[model samples]
Target: MKLRGKTCLVTGANSGIGKITAIELAKQKARVVMLCRNEEKAEKARQEIYKVSGNTDIHIILCDLSSQQQIHDAADEYRRRFTSLDILINNAGIIAGNERLETADGFELTFAVNHLAPFTLTLLLLDLLRHSEAGRIITVSSEAHRFARFDMEDLQLKHHPYSGLNAYCISKLCNIWFTRQLAALTSRSKLSVNCLHPGFVASNFGNSASAAFKALLILSQPFAISNEKGAATTLYLAGSEAPEHISGHYFKDKKIKKPSKAALNDAYAEELWEKSAALTRLELHKVSLS
Candidate 1:
């Protein structure tokens, strides 16, 4: 597809699947905006995307997805730069290792970086996105969500014991929940919100885990797909003509697939939407297109 006139933002684009996705989008001639924490690494990734796609319109804005203030500032900067946004790939995420670290915003690392940040950024940029003929919000959730239904009661992983796998699963589940809620909010509009799992990709996730867990991840990763291969489903959902009419669903291999029972529950979706509004302190009245 030709995204010649579109402006796209891909978070966590300094490396891994996010980088690959950015390169693929740039090949289609979309003006790319990279939201990354590290300027040195992001600058390198910008150069790489230019070389790979032979498109030099890539722009990098430094913002740590882990920090709420930075996310807001980045959104403001982006709004000032672009008249409208066509595509938003909430691809920035983290898989915390054994030790739990808190973000500058006082949130658990995995939860804040993976789920809260994207949700906040998406909500912050809604007006600009709604201005487009067709705006797409693609959330890269995971199959790990099957095991981790969002326990709103234990959102901060307080009551529940923290295992790396469990925390990651909860974050992924939140991603899908947010996507479905967004789909409902944007229904009958110019926006389409969706989520998908990229399958198991051999990436830095293993390296981010603890030593023994990293060993296990690496061992299992041998059977996993490469990042380029893992990018296929997301690229299809993001750039393909087929998904234009599709929204609020999960896909794999370009086909709509069944998500978990919890994923399809409207009650859960509503609960999540309300809770997220409270958690992120979003003023929905200003954003409501209804």
Candidate 2:
């Protein structure tokens, strides 16, 4: 599919799969908007994308996904600058340290950045996306979700023992649940939403991990795929025509794959949607995709 006239927004576009995805989209002449946290890093990545793709339409909007206020501001800024959105990629995530951390909104740090931020941002931009001819929402989940122990009562992991690996796993599980619920909500529309496992690219994704996790990452570096290879599935979902009408599914290696039984629980998915809505203070009754 041609992306020349498409408008795509990618989060965490300053590095890793996000940066590669942005660069590839720009190469196809898409009007790309990169939402990043660091101005310096974003500018550097923007320049690199421009130099590589020779597409000067790249724009950057700095947003720290950990803060709900910042996410709101960024969404507003995006609306002010753009009229419609064809593709929205929620690709930013982090593995917090062993010590539990909380965001400004008082939510667990891992959950806030990996799940809530994208959940809130997507809802804010739903109208714009629905306005497009064909809208797609691609979230980068992980296979690590298979090990997640989801506690609906303690979604924030407040009562459970906190560990970086566990927190990261749960957050990824939320990503799949979010994608499924969102796809169901937009099924009657032209929008398509899906999540994927990006094959553990050797990047700085583990920089904020705990000492043990960081060491594990270091040990696995030689076996991990390169950033370019890791981004293949994301770019496939973004640019290919194969998945235009496919929604509420998981992908790995650019093909549909069955997620864990937990991810397939419709009841759990609906509950998660409600919980996320409450956390984001979003009035679900007012949200209309049709």
Candidate 3:
């Protein structure tokens, strides 16, 4: 898909893989929307993309993904401003410190930002996406999803040991589950949804992490790929031809990879969708899967 006239929104575009993805999309002449938590950082990144891509149509909106209210307001504001959306990239995420934290909404921090934020925002923008000729929803999941196993009894991980790594992995699994379910719902519509694992890049990913982990990330930076290299798969899924035809799949290195069995379970996906809808107070639309 040529992105010359497309409008694309990218979350967490202030730095890391998201920034590079937005810049490349802008280079393709797509009107880029950078949704970030910090206005100052987002403005700087927006200026950088505008200068490098020579596309002055780049825009920025402040959105703290960790808060449900902020995401809802941002999505509504975006709808009020833009008539249609061609692409939505749900790339914002957090790997909290070793100690578990909760968002203002009382849900676990990792789960709220990494998974629920995308879930709420995408559903809110479904109509605008349906209005477009080709609509794509690309979420940034992680290979760490393999470490997650669905536990209906303890969905919040309150009963289990509360390690940040476990929460992060579970949230990644939620991303894949959400993608599969959304793709199923929009199968006959113009919208297509998919998720990917951008490889470990040398970026500021763990700034909020524990000191030991931050040190480890710094030490591993020399071996990690550049942010631009890490964002290759995202750009492919967003701007390449016929990505809509390949929806409901997990990708890495621009190639489809099998996710965990839990990620592909139809029942689990549906359950997750229902739970997410309830948490976000989002009205669920009936999807004619027949």
Candidate 4:
């Protein structure tokens, strides 16, 4: 698909794969809106993207995804500034410290940012997306989802022993389920919703992780892919016509790949959707999931 006039919103656009994705979109002449938490880093990245892509149409929205109110405000701000949203990329994620941390909303930090943030933001922006000719939603999941021991009763990980890795894995698994459920709900619309594993790129992703986890990530860097390669699948899904008609699928290396068996469970997906809706206080009736 030609992106010359497309409007794409990418979360976490200040660094790592998200930054690369935003740069490429700008290169394609897409009007890129970068949603980031840090104003200084976001401005730096935006300037670099402009220098590299030579496209000054890039915009920024300050949002800390860990907060529900911030996510809502970000969405509202987008609507106030932009008319159409052709692509919405849920790219921001976090691996919290070894200790379990909660967001301002009192939810697990990882779960709140990785899953609920996108869930809330996407639903809030659904109307603008549907206003486009063909809207797309791409979420960044991970192979780590296979390690998730999802417990529907304890979605917040409050009852279980907390491990940063485990929480992150569970959040990634939720990403897939969210993608599936959202795709099914928006089937009748012009929206294409999908998720992907970006191949573990060597970047500053685990900076907030525990010391041990950070060391492990650093040690694994020699075997990890580059940021540009990590963003390839995202760019493919965002700009390529191949996935324009594809929805509810998981991709790796830009090809549709099966997610874990647990992620394929429709029941779990539905339950997760309901739980997420309740957590975000999203009225079911407001969503035209027909």
Candidate 5:
């Protein structure tokens, strides 16, 4: 009951890493509000989590990450309903096939959900988090971020052929970039923002992926870790007190790890932040480095 009076919101809390994270948080007695795309799955997971954790404070809000408008509206409604936010876990992501895809906001699907949605939603809920005694933001990035190349000219990959890996890597890279920048922005405050790579887990993560990727996932099932193990780092980051002061870092297996050179590029992070603000048409507050 460490988090008995606290409130936490988790995106994509219906399954995989998100589901486990939510359940653990609920076990710790936090008010877990799950933002999911499907009401049926969300309700089912909510009931199961409540049953297992013996915590009935689980609530659900419907929001499709692929749509920016829904994100904005969902944030608004959430803020109106909740008084404080202690933890935010951006765990939803996608790896579309070789074909190119775009969101309702006209941005690449991978970039929109994996990066832009978090960017927008986090900023929207910053005030609520700041009001809490110990605010934490945990984004589920991937180790594949090492393969990303940040090109200002082709952020959406409009100039090149569509490769799911390329887009997925770029989105994960952006997750690190956003986390670093956000941690810097809140350095003077009690809020801690960070991202992590949950080791390759045997889950439904690649269900929507390309045929080749799906086959590879099936072949590597035995080698991949379980979803419970993958959710461990996230739970530690979200619920434990050891990392209270640690911010703006990457993690794998619950320990901080160095990101790639590109992921560490401050200039690229700033540029991407500005570009994301423009694309989302959001007027953001200026962040100070002091």
Candidate 6:
């Protein structure tokens, strides 16, 4: 389906694969709402998107995914501006390395931004998304999830020595789990939810790599996909016709891939969903699937 006149919101649309995906979506005539944390950076990227695509319909709102209050305000502002939404892309994420730190909300920075922020935002947007003929939730996950499973007892990473990549891996795993849970909840609803690993995109996102990972980045950067190439799969999931009936699957290069065993566990998905609701203190009234 052509995205012409369709409204889509892409978190972290100002850079990396998210930036290219936003540009491609705009090229398809979709009106994009870029949710970014930094105003100056977002505006610069916005202008670049407009300059290249000649699509002046792009707008920006500042919302730091690391903070709960900021996410609420961002969602409120977005709802106030848009009507009849079609797509919601949860592409914002982070990796806090070298030192363990928490967001203003007292959650690990990586977990907060990479997992909880999108989870919270999606719940808030369900009402608007359900208003559409069909809605899509494209969560940008990572292959790193293969390294770790959700530690249900310590979702906050308070008890153990923190490893940045490990935290990031679990967060991405939560992304897939969230997708499955949300999709199951909306099975009879009009919305769809799916997650993807961008295939090791050559982006600056790994700059915070724990000293150990920096070497890995240097070694892998040469073989990593470019920004536009990395964005192709996301663009397809966000706008392609083939994915209309698909939901809760992990995708790469426009195809479904087998996720790790942990990602497919119904029990874990449910546990994570409940834990997330408790953490955010947000109740999502599930629509009947029957």
Q: In order, what lDDT does every prediction score?
A: 0.83, 0.92, 0.87, 0.93, 0.88, 0.87
Residues 93-159, candidate 1, lDDT per residue (tens digit)?
8777877677876788888888889889998998878887788888888888889845777766766
| Per-residue lDDT of candidate 2, residues 1-290 (tens digit) | 56898999999999999999999999999999999999999999999999999999999999999999999999999989988899999999999899999988999999999999999999999988888888999999999999998688997899998887899999999999999999998999998899999997997899999999999999999899999998889899989655578999999999999999999999999999998988999867777866
Model 6: how far residue 32 lies from native, Å:
0.4
Q: How far is candidate 6 from the true structure (C-alpha RMSD, Å)?
A: 1.6
* Superposition error at 274 for model 3 (Å): 1.2
The collision pairs in model 4 are none
What tens digits encode model 4's per-residue C-alpha lDDT throughout 221-265? 989999999999999999865546789999999899999999999
Clashing pairs in 1: none
Name the runs in model 2 displaced over 4 angstroms. Answer: none
Off by over 4 Å in 6: 285-290
lDDT per residue as tens, model 5, 1-290: 15776899999999998999899889888999999999999999999998999999999989999998999899988978887888899999988888889876789999999999999888888888887788889999999999876577688898887788789999999999999988887889988888999999977798878899899989999899988999999888887654577889999888999999998989888888889988988877552222
**Over the stretch 1-290, how does candidate 3's per-residue lDDT look in tens digits?**
78998999999998999999999999999999999999899999999998999999998889998898998899888978888899999998888887878889999898899999999888877777777787889999999899985485556687788777778889999999999998888788867788999999888898888788788888998899999999999999998654556778899998899999888889988999889988888767542331
Summed over model 4, clashes come to: 0
Which stretches in model 3 have alpha-carbon errors above 4 Å? 286-290
TM-score of 3: 0.95
Instruction: Using TM-score as the measure, name the better of candidate 2 and candidate 5.
Output: 2
Who wins the lDDT comparison? 4
List the candidates' TM-scores in order: 0.95, 0.98, 0.95, 0.98, 0.96, 0.96
